[model samples]
Target chain A: MTEIPTTRRLDGHSALITGAGVGMGRSHALALAEAGAAIVVQDIVAETAEETAGLVRERGAKAHVMVCDISDVAAVNAGVEAARADLGPIDILVNNAGISGGMAKFDDIDEAYFDRVVAIHLKGTFFAAKAVLPDMRAKGWGRIVNVSSIDGMVGCPSSAHYCAAKAGVLGLAKAWAKEFAPWGITVNAVAPGYIDTPMMDGLLDDAGKAAHVAARIPLGRMGVAADLTAAIAFLVSEEAGFITGQTISPNGGEVIVGF
Target chain B: MTENSTNQPANSRFDGQVALITGSGKGMGRSHAETLAARGARIVVQDVDRAAAEETADSLRAAGGDPILAIADVSDVGAFAEAIRAVEAAAGRIDILVNNAGIAGGSPAMEEIDEANYDRMFDVHVKGAFFATKAVLPGMKARGGGKIVNIASVAAMGAVGSRAHYCAAKGAVLAMTKSWALEFAPWKINVNCVSPGWVMTPMVHAVTTAEWRKTHIDAEIPLGRYAEPWEVSALVAFLCSAEADFITGQTVSPNGGQVIVGI
Candidate 1:
């Protein structure tokens, strides 16, 4: 009934995806590469990042592996520099690297635990955007997609840390969008809802997942990587020039939000 | 629309889908038609202006799409509903419905606006989008799945000054889009809204001068320019595509950093 267009929307561009080892980040890398973008796959896990890079290369697009914890500002800057040297300047930045802590209510949550979650999700996003802005500014064109979540929009019970970090990224995208639009750069967030990714597997078992979907998600299923990736592809394409500072929630009707 | 457009199909995303776009007589609606037709949707051009609608049909035919015409103003609920059913009968089924039928509310301050003008604004944008979706839902549900994109404006998101009716109408459309997404999800219908920022449409040209363009676009708008119709159309077409199957209850604004906060 439908066919995904084979048009390469990102030809001659280089994209940097954080947390590209597995799940949503890996999916975004593959989809962008499929759209003709040369990918810089960055993740703390060197092996998985390389695995994603290999996948990108197999698609006949260039790929470079950069291994670094995105939370480390110095390391992220170095990785961006090395990635630029190996491939090209980052024309697109998907601030996708994130960490979700196991459920700990506010009383049980330790300072270290909260800091780590915020460090990885919010701090990591901020510094990564900082690292890639100069190149995009000079070029006068770029795309930045921050991967937020349903928890970000609507608060998640017992997952306040994750929610705060995720929501922080949304604010970051808005501020960056306003700041960078003059340079022809767009910054936006894609807040996904209950996606069937590795992250969910870590949080919920099969039964929990099914019950949640049946109770909450109207689509009657968990979202897939393709759903998020397709949105990222649209946000990064040339046709999306007029769009910035927006959060496109591909949640299968889970959360109907409006201005 | 050009081949460089995002909706320019390399393999036809909507190869067999039938898309019914209201207000296809001119502006962004026509571009939406072109974008979808390029991807192989059988278009049903619905517009009150017969002359302009015919022009759009001719272009669609030239672009290799066999389009149907439903010459009815969307605000005419009974007549437009009948026209929609005619489209369903003619085209076998309705797969996509773009509630793009709208008129520009003139720049009259809230007090200066008359009751008739206010009613006209809501009648076209709000009532039109609402009933049109109501008309199309059964066919879409029967067909297993469907995509509905309501065309909103950036004016709905902020105080754009004057034309409170237009803003209110678009704001209602945004709210209605949310309700529809929730209400229609059981039927596998994905309802969404596209709030474009300062597109260079007739609605804009009717109000602005060179000075308005130079100052307003450059000063207030971040991208320092307005959007081309295809730019907004490509986004609408994306929402209608299978790739966007999981996206519902969402409002995508391609407004070049104008009025970013939509919370």
Candidate 2:
């Protein structure tokens, strides 16, 4: 068999990853750096963003830190502008920042909590993508990977707001994929199942809930941050240019939603 | 858009492994075989035509692959079972199965569809994949785990012209992929589907003119071009690799933004 040689896939690309302070966002930031892309690590917390930037620098890749709450459109625009100014035009954007919005019964759900989740999860994704398009358009090359959840694809009890927001993110990805394809940008979403992250700890509530979720996964284990990153890495790669407007579910067979 | 080959390392993701790809004589199936075999897999090229299967095997051999040939109509349960046995006997075990054998039947309107054509479509796509998994399940379970990628179409997810039978069959494959994934999770078998949009292949070329494709199909696809078979194969290879261990029961589409447009 003819073996192709390995080379850095993102040697000249600069990526902006939101929620890069911890969990999947951090992992994505590190992985993109390792793949040779300079990173802009953005998080609501200044310390966490700096922490992630430190890790990115350790990998021999340049890192710039931006602190902002993505729910605020002005903050998102400013953060993205600062990232591009510091790191050059963003070639890749990973909208990984999100909140779980703690579970609430559908009928008793607080209007304020629902709006908060939507603003951050759905609206935030839209803002991030919108912010990066100009540079991507000028260069005619870009990749956008939105971090959604299995809850978005399947109904999860007591997480209607989270589900709706995540689902909306998918819609945004598809819409933007078409709108941006003419400019050589590809937009996709990743729906991760129960990954072993701080977020999962907050979502499951107990060991029994975690175990129950794990049992349902065909892979027989909770996914790790690396699992999610692997899919993200593939989506953001140059080889994946033909793949756009799709949602890849790395859920370990927990839920299968096609199309 | 410029088409530059990505310089990805040839990791032995499928080394010391045996893969069975149905209808691998040409098109996307051939692409899948080449991708997997290039990554160090011994391929079992299955096709309904012996000559076609041998042709694919010959190409694999020329590319430094130790390929075996299995000629059988997958729609026939007995033939498919016999073909699986032949593969096991020749290669020891099956570590991967790509159900890429499918026919694009005439796109008759729903009411105009004949029972014969509809049944043939379902028999070949849905039932063939179902029984192929059943045949390989025992060996894969005994060997610990395996990967199964069913080659579905974007039609499964949404409407596609008048090909109701084709869409229905592909849709069934998608649903069955999930069911098998859930049932075989304990056994460690990963089942997924790869749904492609408009791909530039002999089948497609025979049906549509280049000008027609450019004006009607390519214009609609967000990527502004039809997908090469290798692009589809690349995604399937990833799904079959170790890196994709946590991804199962998912329909990963490499459709150049077609699905997003919504039928």
Candidate 3:
């Protein structure tokens, strides 16, 4: 058997991950740290951010913690600046913070709920990307990976707000990829399907619901955070410079959506 | 132009792997072959032109790679199957298959397209990929897992003038890619599509003049330039590696933001 060799592909780089306290965000932070990048673990919960920072430290990489709500533009900008002050210029940014929002029919969705979901997933992605662009533009290199959902690509019933916001993330990523390509920045999106995370627990009523969702996946299982982390790692690597404005769906063959 | 930067260390993700790239004689297919071979894959260069296939294999051998030439027109199912068998027998196993053989027809209006042009387009792009996958599936299943990458175009998603046949064929390729991805998931085989915009290849050059390309095609692209063959190959190499083990049924387009802006 040929073993896949692991290397410090992101050595000397700095990364800031939103929602890094748990789930896919935490996984990305650790993976980036393992690849030799200093990490800025940002989340709404201070304790979880610190925990993620400690995990990064365990991997022998420097880490900083930031506790702020991603949906707030001012807070995101401030957090990004603070992260840069502590860890130097951020070379990578993962917009992984998002909320599933309430499941309701399109007509039943309230204005507040729709706005909140859009604020966190779509607007938050825009704000974070905007905050990091100056540093990346100055350095002439950067990588941004937005976390969209398979629901965004193929509409899901009772999740109109969530799906719309996720779809907006894809558009934001592509627009930024084009606008920033001259500065050597690459923007991409990762659409994960039915990941086994705390978020999944919140969405599913029980183990049976989770199993039912898993059964629908052609790969015969729900994706783990590591599955998405691997794709993000590849997209943010030095060799992946040419791949920009693309959406890589690591959905276990659940949906074959094209962009 | 050099396909890869010399400063970067060679990725050995495909070490001890065998890759069979259709239409490997020139352009993007050649780039795919070179990139994979450089990454430690033994090359099975398949093309309709025997001389071109030999040329690609010879270059691989010169670069300290083990390569074999297989001459078979991809549109011919029988010949293509034989070619696959020969490669599998020679290389011991086929670890990767790139369904990249394609032809571009003159951009005649859709109404003006005859049966011959339409059939040829579908035969080479759609049927070729279908039969190639059919031939490689059993071995991949027996061996536990493998990778298959089909080359598609941005036209599949949107319209392109005078190339309706080409667009339709690529769309079929995308559809088939998804179907195979679903069917092969249990066997652990990953299937994906690479939809490139206007890449700077000899075939592209043969089709359009530099002046027209600059004023029309290049202007529409946000990156303000067409992709180098290596740029397309880089994504294919990534898709074929262990890094993309979780990726399947995805159409990753490296089009300089052409299709994204709906151009």
Candidate 4:
């Protein structure tokens, strides 16, 4: 039998995870809740976020579900405040909601497609971080784990827009790492490869594309949500105070770039 | 030994794979070899020190596994060539490569870091891992698939007091992994890297005094303890397995709640 720690890693701390309806955002919410944090599950899909909140409640944790499109600034601010009013200060923020849209070669990318990707991922992350920054600064302790992608670090064939936005997340993390370090607000990101999730399923449904993408990774397999969860869990934990402005990749040995 | 055996599953994910681990004379490399061997992979124990490499090979033999010994300085060009040729002769195929051989030079400040230290660090980590991958890639392409895992450090993610060149070199390795992954993807070759935090290796223990370590490494990681080599080895083995097929162009961070860089 394995030993269990007496204290929950995030006990008494409240966490706000954007895109908490599905995919990585959902995983982060549940993982943080398991670690003893009250959760604010915010998503564009009201019912989906509520479903996630229901799961959290079943786990005997306090959860407030909010329906708000993270891409909208005013909505994000109000949602954050509602969460703070209900659960106390938001000590941890997980910016995991993102959209890959349709994959296309760089030359094929249209302005609308590119703009949407940026607005949801890049802009969404900025506004969410803005909303939580003051509260975290007041408390003098905060953790931000952004969800990026391996494509962000190294460019991809049809994922130029997605890659650029994710790369933006990294830049944002670095700048904030410096900006928030003084306030003890550590920010980092987790870049996953082709993780097996609803998002991946949709992308990989085309057999030709799936085959082409799968052959590129070194691990000879697709990533599971568990793989990413383990990495994020370590990052947002209190033990990760000194680990700011860093990008941790949990891809199966497919891209061997420097840390 | 004909076939090594341990508690890992048979028809194991690593079955039929030949894993070449650098610096297997001891520490993280040895742990990687032992674990991979247990998973039914043929092992290539490599190190700069001859006796140490052979000793590790002997240990694998005693453990009921087959391991070939290759003693050569990874920084030396001719030595790396010979090592690859030797593995081809022993194992008949190169299915996996783990670039774990490296040196952790002194704790001199960035300005005080001398040229000799910088060159040596890059030579072993950058040049060594580079050529080794270059030599093995052709064989992997011929075989239609393979895996490469480079051992990077959290230091590469940012400035960590000293070891500037080491950080830069590892960063290059990380970048190179991405390029190589894209280049070799058509051939079904996957290349990835592992960037660990302060793990309790002999080199680390030797370079860092107890007092210095207490204040630096121990105090930095959130877990408040150094990682065991086996912990990193588990991650390496998993990456080499079939389960990680879609994981290319990525770095796996196994630091104990430390090094929160972007994923």
Candidate 5:
């Protein structure tokens, strides 16, 4: 059989991903790069961020690395500006950097602790979006893919703060989608269920805990990072232009709420 | 603008393929059929009226393409099923289906909209689309993949005037889309719903005069004009393409500025 030539749908696009040092962010960075996007990779952890950048470069797309704590407004702004200057204006922005520390009772959680959760998950997203909004507005074409959690849609027992922040991100995306529709900027959110990321591995170190969580999922297994990366690539591509203001749940059939 | 093969590309994109769009006798349905045919999809022009359906098919044929006429009353299950059978037998395979056949029923209020009107809307928009998919599912599964785009409306997402029954029908369509998408994903059948905004369709034409449409429907749309059917069709074609394999169990809206507030 002759080989069927297929064109890459996302050719020549440029994408910037935050928290690309590890977990889902790193996977999405590499995936987008593979699909022909020049990548700007950022991670709170310097080494991991550089590693992700190297991976993108190896995949034949230009890659730049920036190390910044996205939770800090000043740092997030500086990092975005640096990346823009180095790689060109970003057409896609993946707000994938987030933290989910183990379960804690709502009453037991202090204000400071809750504030930190909002800082990284919610505040970081706003600041990064603020940094890139003008450029996105100028281009008249942009795709902002915010990474939310299944917790945002459905509550988890001991994750009040985590759930609230992710849920806030969903609200943020919807409001911005309406505001930016005229400018051709699309905003969307992706909520993933228990995926096999480094974050999950840390909590489910023992076989028993991992098995317990996997059993609860309808698919009988947790999702892999690649599962979500596949979806992220589609949403950020040109094909998904009409798909804005929607939240796609690639949770292996976990959250079953229909329109 | 681009040419694709019929087998769906190796990456599994809807490369060279064909689709049949019903209710495409005009409006949004016609838009989807034409757009897909432009992208290398053989067109199966389907409609209730034989002449209208043939007219749409002829246009596609005249444009350096071949299309088959698929005529039937979608409200009738047997008629819908037979239409799918004919399309499959003639086209050899149904790479895509756009369930865009629909009507708008009006009443003073929910209480006034009697059972007959309610059932009529369900028969064509919901039940008709249901059996059509059921008939094609096996063929699509056997062929190793397919795409089905259910034409839902924003009315399903929110409330509209005297449309309780219509809303109920589209709501069922939206729910059915999720269940079907999950069931069919493994077989590579990507089932999705495209909920269009207020569009310039015959249904709109019947309910409102040009003057009324300008003030009532057009003003409410964030984009300030009823969507041309082609805009809605373009999105549906993208979903049917291989580019959207990972995007099952989703509802894509092309409403100018109407946002689904929550959930």
Candidate 6:
């Protein structure tokens, strides 16, 4: 005799995901598509970006391709404007684009490499969010999810630049959450653990996966793309209206930090 | 790590799941029960008072939800655990637990605060939530996964005069939620906290006058009003949903931008 909710579909919403060509980004694109959101798949690579867009279109949702380097302010602004013209106002943004550079000690890493890492992870998120804020502010409703890493929550060994940029990204989201709450905008972050995505292709062989799963992860296996996407789908959905400025880590219980 | 419990259909977040919520006689707890019931969860409405609990059950029946009433005071650890066992015996298993039972105090000053009020605050808010969680953990661990959402207050992040005991108690809830998240992560149990700001509840209504409520609701809160109970219930429902599987050790505040603090 339970009365289920009438509907929880995102029939009228338009979303844009950065680096949606593959891995977690592509998975998120598909998940949102299933929920009935028109999608703008943004990736620097045109070929893969179009692939994700095609998948979105297959689900019967409108799909647009936005190809641009998110770190560059002018390029991101222009790209978003074009996407809005093709699709609609860019209200939902998922800053899922990031580069995990090779391991480098504090002294071994040079300034340019660090700056580049920061540019992609930290600056890329900042500029992309800046580009979409206009539509959200005007409409008085927006949802933004900054894709961080487990290393961001608990500093990992090596990759200092990646960790710093990822951690700083959360700071930016929290600042925006407080500043933009009046506009009905909610900004949050998702820090995934050792997820089995295209980014981890090199280390995801059967042997490596088994050894790592037994030694560290409490959940006994590496996470898949859907694990991260489920959280993102929830954050951007209307059901998550009250939550903001917080980070949810889907790391197979690898890193645990709380207040 | 467990990849969450697969994504559910758009219509039902619970559907066939059993949810046991404490302090469901009235206010936020009752609202949470109604929300989950509407979304297809079998609710175990736990409250100490039979009359109040039955009223909630009647409301649920009116809404087409058949809710089971479990009468037990959460402050009594032994009785509460037995009640939880009774629920497990009847409902197969409990998939979600919402610790929403708490008391209030509008005291004159800290100097006038009595030992009885201080102890009662800790007994209900802190111990009640803690032991109830303890009772459910064995079943949850054996079953491999579950969701636990503890209710906290925005006062934990800010100062409230003469309510230091309440704040301290709620603060402990937030702190232990982190530990539970870490401790129970391996079992696929996600423990999180929802620290609400001001909300339109019977508790708030009984304590404040119209002018006072208006002054705070209009001038203080950034959203220009206190949250409706359903708004708070929406968040609790989300955390219990499979979509929040990877989200452990996280504390979300639904305070209408009244208090914003970074983790």
**Cα lDDT tens digits for candidate 1, B52-138:** 999999988987789999999899999999998888888899999999998875678989889999889989998899899999999
Ranking by DockQ: 1, 2, 6, 3, 5, 4
**Model 3: runs farther than 4 Å from truth?**
A1-8, A58-60, A102-116, A178-184, B1-12, B110-113, B202-213, B216-218, B261-263
The reply for model 1, stretches above 4 Å from the true place, is: A1-8, B4-12
Put down candidate 5 lDDT per residue, A1-259, tens digits, no spaces.
1111323355667788989999899999998888788898988898998888888999889998888888998987888888889988887899998998467788878998899888998999988888888888889888898999889988789879999999989988888887777778888888888788888766666686567655655444567787787667767765456556777776655566745
- Cα deviation of A250, candidate 4, in Å: 3.6
Best by DockQ: 1
If scored against the real structure, what TM-score would every candidate get?
0.96, 0.91, 0.88, 0.61, 0.81, 0.91
Ten residues in sequence with the least summed lDDT for candidate 4 chain B: B2-11
Rank order (by TM-score, best first): 1, 6, 2, 3, 5, 4
Question: Which numbered prediction scores highest in lDDT against the true structure?
Answer: 1
Poorly placed runs, candidate 4 (over 4 Å):
A1-8, A104-114, A157-160, A201-206, A253-259, B1-103, B107-263
For model 3 the local lDDT of residue B259 reads 71
lDDT of 6 by residue, B1-263 (tens): 11122334553368889899899988788888988877778999999988889988998888767788889989999999999999899888998999999887765477766899899999999999999999889989999999999999888876777678888999999888888887888898988888988887777888889999888866766655677777788778878887666667777787766776645
- Give each model's whole-structure lDDT: 0.87, 0.84, 0.83, 0.77, 0.76, 0.83
Error of 6 at B41 (Å): 1.4
lDDT of 1 by residue, A70-176 (tens): 99999999999999998888989999998775766888778999988999999999999899999999999999999998889987778789889988999999999
Model 2: what TM-score? Answer: 0.91
lDDT by residue (B1-263, candidate 4, tens digit) is 22223322232348778899988888788888887876678898889998888888887787667888877888888878887897797789989999899877756678877888888888999999998888788899899988888888878875676767877888888888788777777677777787888778777787778989778754665444576666677667766766455556667666645566554
Question: For each candidate, what's the DockQ?
Answer: 0.53, 0.47, 0.33, 0.14, 0.21, 0.37
Model 5 residue A244 lDDT score? 67
